[model samples]
Target: MELKGFSTKCIHGGEEGKYEFDVIPPIHLSSTYQLKYEDQDFVYSRVDNPTRRVLEDKMSVLEKGVASLAFSSGIAAISTVVLSFVKPGEEVILSEDIYGGTKTLFMEILSKRGIKYKYVDTRYADRLEDEISDDTRLVMIESPSNPMMRITDIEKVSKIAHEHGLKVAVDNTFASPYLQNPIELGADITIHSATKYLGGHSDIIAGTATFKTMEDYELVKLHRTRLGGVLSPFDSYLLLRSIKTLEVRMERHCKNAMEIAEYLSNHPKVEDVLYPFLKSFPQYDLARSQMRLGGGMISFKLYTDDQDKVDVFLNSLSIMKKAVSLGGVETLIEQPATMTHRALPDEEKKRLGITPGLIRLSVGIENVEDLISDLENALRNI
Candidate 1:
């Protein structure tokens, strides 16, 4: 039975009802299964696990993909997926506003192995044709990109990439499957750091990669198994439990984020607010076309660039925690220049508008008024 509703899918999508008639899927912790036949579904935990399969199955359905793979971490998923498609000489074209950790992987790790990469503004997807080269193998983007809140047109970019016989992978972490599904928008691959909104409680560290085609799915699964980056059965069970409430959690998250974006936009201390749904956003139309909601991320610049004032504001915050990662039940605030994107060079940070005054907030499913009051109190200090 196919689940038609998003919330229904989250709760019951991958459930097979084969675990001794248990209403909920029980955790299968056996690292090795006793096999009596040559061809068996379960052999080793690294290759596959019942619990992890359920999570992957749910993710595939949620992302509207043919299949999905669970990884030990988000970076591991990115590494496996990229390596599966690209070789040492092949290149990957990336959005300039991607996550800092990704930049490190390409520049520090893959580059040393002869893999080349170039950054471009994917917001204008047609620009890809101008930069496309024979070496280009993959086009990677993050909608409502990390820290900067920039958006890329997935359908337009996917069209251009497909025309060039290239694979398009979208980091769908910021806008969870509830808000957006990259595969539905024509992307070949959709990736997520399930540690975020999928976990909803910041308790687990996991990632997922969903493929539009079974061929890509089988290929990536081979790499993931060889690399031994499979998610543990225990963690998989926890993530599966977390995903059941994803729909309800995201609803509150979006509601709080929209209200917070509006509040910050009107604040005098805030120089500017960057949220996809805001009319003032440079890519508002495109964002609306790609995403169902504004999402829970909001970035704003402070009127003053003084480090002292920034510290004062950060210290004054009572509710929002000053943290690094995002998409949790509790609001988190951070300066990307010093936290998430700090690995990039000074010039790159400057180019991306990650400044001392820039504040990135992952609005959680908290009381809207309380969150706004916390921001107000913090801004007053600044």
Candidate 2:
């Protein structure tokens, strides 16, 4: 039988030994459990759920982490982690290329509590180092950054942060656990918007945080419980099912994205293509050193910045949907200026090179020839 591999484990891991003779985990929807003794493991759903616990355990194994906690939404996980590690007076270092929602959360909520945060171009270690201060508690980053495709050197960044006595957290959402594991590269914690890649389908909205140490786990778990952003048992079950096909789905995504990126790079209408696997990518070497595959996300700049042209191109796309989220079986396309990164200031967007012409694509596990033809048809219509 060859003892089955990761792919098989994705389908049947976590509790195989506990639930004998069962092919799949049964959803435990009970909100409370019988406290036969003191300090019961299952007191309330807010604190934990059986389905979520299994999901967390699987994530721990996937990310090679000591422990994990699941959340209702990606923002919920990020917010809880921030609150757990960062204090009002303390500072946290992050990259300028993070998700817009995360940036907004810091500016609006965390900032109100006096917690200062600095955003640096984390692609370079020197720039990231300059942002660190005596009050810095954490260094947060996203590799192949949101909507821009900027790749950060996690190992180098982690090393620098560790030397400074700062905890390191990487948003491993884009790459997913199949492509990259941040904790293995010295990150204290690896975060994911399981709503995206981990779910593998757009059916569920969930998030996860996997920690390298029990102390961090206990802290994040406490915050997760207190914040009350736990995922529902049903959603947890869906996520678990999705994980089974993640490897296959992600492989197709990577292949499709690479071919699409290459196609766009050569297109007369495209100004630039920003995919880590592309040789022209600035961080191509770094991406190779860390990730197994480039994953599904691709960001490209069009030759024209006119809003009308952008709208026309997006509208003409038949296969790709104009959506906000990523990492699904179906392709998603979006204009950062008016979509995901709209909350960002004009000046900041300009500095980050998130021009009006930029288009972020979440390539799906569709046939490559069909996908490319769809792009070609869309470009012609534009």
Candidate 3:
């Protein structure tokens, strides 16, 4: 029997009942599996592990990709995926509003290898064609883009890129597999910062890459293996356990976020609110067409421009933690100007709409009324 439902896949997607007959897969902690013959199933932990295999299989189903690879972190997955195709002198098009770590990878790492990239406004799919070059190998984007909540038309962008012989890879960290499956929308590869919603907790740090074809899968896997960026057996188990509750957790996350966005939109202290589900958002229709849910991320600017006011608001938030990464069960609030995107220059940050007054919130599964009160108290104090 096979599971077709999303929630069913969450519980039984991988090699669950096939091995050990345990209700949940056990941790395969052995670094070396017994291999009498050359035809043995598992040999070394780096090459593969029983626990990690289950995660890869499960991730494949969730992302609607032909195969999946688990990496040490989100950056490892992105680096391996990009390096798999992009060579010296070649270029790739990336989302202008992508997370800061990604921008660093392009400038600090890829540039040293002679691989180049251009940052573009991917929300407008039509603008993508104007940026592609003969040397371009990949079209990478982050829909509901990092902290900005920008939406990209996956089908439109993928179609245009395919015509130009470019592969499309979407960083689906913000939306998670519950809200969106990029592979289903024609993306060649879908990447995830599994440390976020996939883990559903702040305990694990991991990444995943799901490929549309076996060839792409094998290529990236080869890069991952050679680069030695595989996920550990223990962390793999944690990720698998987290996936089982992905559907239910996402339900609460989406619910809490919509209410929070609505609350902020009307607040006197909030100058602007950015949420895909909000009708006031420019890309609401595009987001609805590609994503099943609006996701838990929200970015808004406060009415005041004073940097000191940010500290007051952040310090007043008793329930929300001030942190960098997002999508955990506990709500996280951060000021990108001083935290995640601090590496970015002031002009560039301003151009990307990461304003001095902007606040990025990763809404969690806490009681909606409680969250509202928390935000209200903070806003009033600020």
Candidate 4:
């Protein structure tokens, strides 16, 4: 009852009914729940599902927020939250370096709908004020941001946004609840692509958005229902199972990543390594101050700018798979310029530091030595 540790919370939180009939939570596969009376707890899976409810509840507690909403995909969760807060002609301020899909949503979809966005370099918290406009309704950011591994000062940015009467949303997919809680850092909402870290093994696709206040929660929840971007009961069940081991898996992931980052930094063929823990990182102090751990992602630029060298490095890898997504049990390596951020124009990609020679590595729970050897061999070929 005391809830002494993270692992304990991971396995037991929001599992109130698991004690009664099932040791493991039952997968409520039914699309609609039978109602014995006019008013019932669950009526439709689209509006609510037992499995998804459990995941939402657990994530809310983990994120230290009032409530959480589940969605069909990460982008769905993002779009719902953005659309809920932002209106036509309203402006949203976001980091220049973010997930490709998110950038597409803001630049392409939201812009087409009359919503404008201001892209700023979030590395300097002071610069945010220059970009913030009267019409800015939301301030979105990704700390330890994707592909580049840049750390933003969430607390400072949240302070700035709150002073301007703007809502702050943070993409916590990179630094999951195990490492950082953005809600506690003064963010109004925390969003996650549960497909990455929360579903740890990379088997399920899901997304979650946690809100600090009940009002914001209901607003997002209503939009989620109306948009029909709801997570399936089966995927919810998978997420629940995966979250039970999140603490353990994240520990291994962080440990392995730090080790690998150090190795890559020392490598002759490596130009620079982007990781939160490295003292050389621009925001090293802030990362240490805000996060419990540096996290599992490592991005580095090769010494050679040759595209062929990059290909050789990726092909030479024996252990790490050349894949697109990250935060899985197995290590994954990919070039963001061509793989993840391929949709962006060349100038925009370069502006975000997603160069052709840049490689992003999602370190896994695999043997650190083996991962190191694999990267070393790959670098040797370069």
Candidate 5:
């Protein structure tokens, strides 16, 4: 049955009535299935697994993609996609304000293999055309980008990339499927770090890549099989369970985040707040046009340049835990300059707005007042 509602799709998208009595899908843990016929549905765990297949199917439904593949981690999914598609000597243009790990992967590891990359401010869609060389084969973008909350015009960028015979891949992890679907907006591939919102509880480290066509899916699936970065059956089952409540979870997350963003924007100590829905945000209109909500991630800069004050404020937080990684039931706060983006060079970090005073918050589903009070107290300490 075709599902129209997002919540309904989350709960029943990949269900095929394999069990008539049981309401929940069973987790198939067997590493290998006995080969009985010439062409059997069951296969080895690395190539395919029942549990992972269901999760992949559900992800495809949510992301509005023709097919989806689950991987061991977010990096694995991204690396596989890049390696599978972009050959040696072909350049991949990426957003300047991107995830540090992704930057390291492309520049450090992939570059050693003769893969070329360019960092551009994809937020300005028109400017992207100038950077597209004959060797440019792909464009990777992270909308509402990590820490900086930069929003790119996916449809515009995808249109520009496609015209130049380059495939567009969007890192939709920050927005999640509930907030955004890159494929629906014209991207060739949509990627998610399921370790975040999709898994919901930070218990699983998994990733997913959804494709607009079956051909691309097959191509990536082949690499995933050979590389053996497939998600485990247990983690796949956990992710499937987490996704069922995604809509409800995201609603609370967005509500809490909007209130926090507003509070931060008004604070005297906050130099800037970077939530997509915040009116003061530079790309508010474009973000609203693309995303369903502001999303749970927020990045703001402290007015003070004092490193001690910044450290004091982060340490002073009682409710919002000072930690890395986002999209959990509890709020997580971190300074990207010293935390997530520390590996990046000082010049590159400053260029991308990863300032020492900049703070990134992954708002949670907690009571809004409590969260605000926590922030207020933290700001007072600063």
Candidate 6:
């Protein structure tokens, strides 16, 4: 059957059983599949599992890529893709504002191995070209960047990288395939922490990497196997089930986020709101041009620089839970400096606009008025 819709693809694409059997995809618990003479399909669970393959196939179709690989966690997926291209003494150009774990992987691990990285402000597309050099093999960026909500020009950056013979890797966790498809805009690889939006309920921890061509696919697949970062069959089943409702979940997430952002912008204790959909955002135009939706994440600053005020604001919230990760059915709020980006130097964090007063909000599929009231009450206490 020719699948024509996203939801349809999610529900039917990876499944093999018919109505006589269970409607849901059966979990292939067996670690090894029996093989005929000289033929092997699923020899072992670690190398290949039938259940995991379904999730990979679903992700490949969603991202419009040639192939997809599942990993134990988002960091594992990122490390696999980065290591596939990066070598000792080589360099990578990355955005100043990125996931804390990714930044740590580059600074703490890769740097120890003599692989260097330069953090650039990709908000200015012109600066990207100036930073590229013969040693720069990859350009990594996270659009609607973490904590800051700043967006990079994917098309511009991809074109510049190609001109310099550099490969482009985009972290599409914030703006999932529902909001943006990086490969369609010339990105060589699209990565996601499927633990967040793709898994929707915050029940599973998994990551995915989708490659644009067979060559790139083989490179990442080899790294995944050698590094032993494959996802479990059970986690794959959870992810597959969660992806079926991604479109609907994301729609509500975007709508609720926009409302919450507006409410925060008007609050007395709020200094600034950093949602791309809002007109007050610096990169509003770019966000509109590149993303299909504004997404559920919002980052805002408090008027007070005092740490006491920040504490009061966080403690006053009744509905929005204080949490580390995001993209769940319930709203989540976190302080990046202490939680996500705690490992980075103070100077580097400040350079990337991560401050003590900055708060990252992941608006959930709750009533808009209730979410706004929760924020307003928290601001009142502040």
TM-score of each: 0.99, 0.97, 0.98, 0.98, 0.99, 0.97
lDDT, residue 146, model 3: 86
Candidate 1 residue-wise lDDT, 1-382, digit = tens: 7679999999899885656667777899999999989989999999999999999999998999999999999999999999999998999999998988999999899999999999999988889999999999999999889989889999999999999999999999999999999999899999999999998898999999999999999999999998988999999999999999999999999999998999889988899999999999998989888899999999999998798998899889999999989999999999888888888899988988999999899999989999999988888876
- Candidate of highest lDDT: 5
The RMSD of every model to the true structure, in order and in angstroms, is: 0.9, 1.5, 1.0, 1.1, 0.9, 1.5
Query: Candidate 3, residues 258-288: lDDT per residue as tens digits?
Result: 9999999999999999999999999999988
Per-residue lDDT of candidate 6, residues 201-228 (tens digit): 9888899999899899988888898999
Question: How accurate locally is residue 281 in candidate 2, as Cα lDDT from 0 to 100?
Answer: 93
Give the TM-score (vs. native) of candidate 5: 0.99
For residue 35, what is the lDDT in candidate 1?
92
Model 3 pairs in collision: none
Model 6 weakest lDDT span, ten residues long: 13-22
Q: Where does the lowest 10-residue lDDT sum fall in candidate 1?
A: 16-25
lDDT of 4 by residue, 142-253 (tens): 9889988888899999999899999999999999999999999999999999999999897988899999999999999999989999999899989999999999999999
Q: List the residue pairs that clash in candidate 6.
A: none
Model 3: residues with Cα > 4 Å off, grouped in runs = none
State in Å the error of residue 22, model 5: 2.1
How do the residues 26-87 of candidate 2 rate in per-residue lDDT, one tens digit apiece?
89999988879898778888998888888988888788899999999989999999999998
Against the true structure, candidate 4 reaches a TM-score of: 0.98
Q: What is the alpha-carbon lDDT of model 3 when measured against the actual structure?
A: 0.92
lDDT of 2: 0.89
Clashing pairs in 5: none
Q: Which is superior by lDDT, 4 or 5?
A: 5
Candidate 5 residues 286-342, lDDT tens each?
999999999999999999868899999999999999989999888999999899999
Clashing pairs in 2: none
Assess the local accuracy of residue 29 in candidate 3 as a C-alpha lDDT between 0 and 100: 95
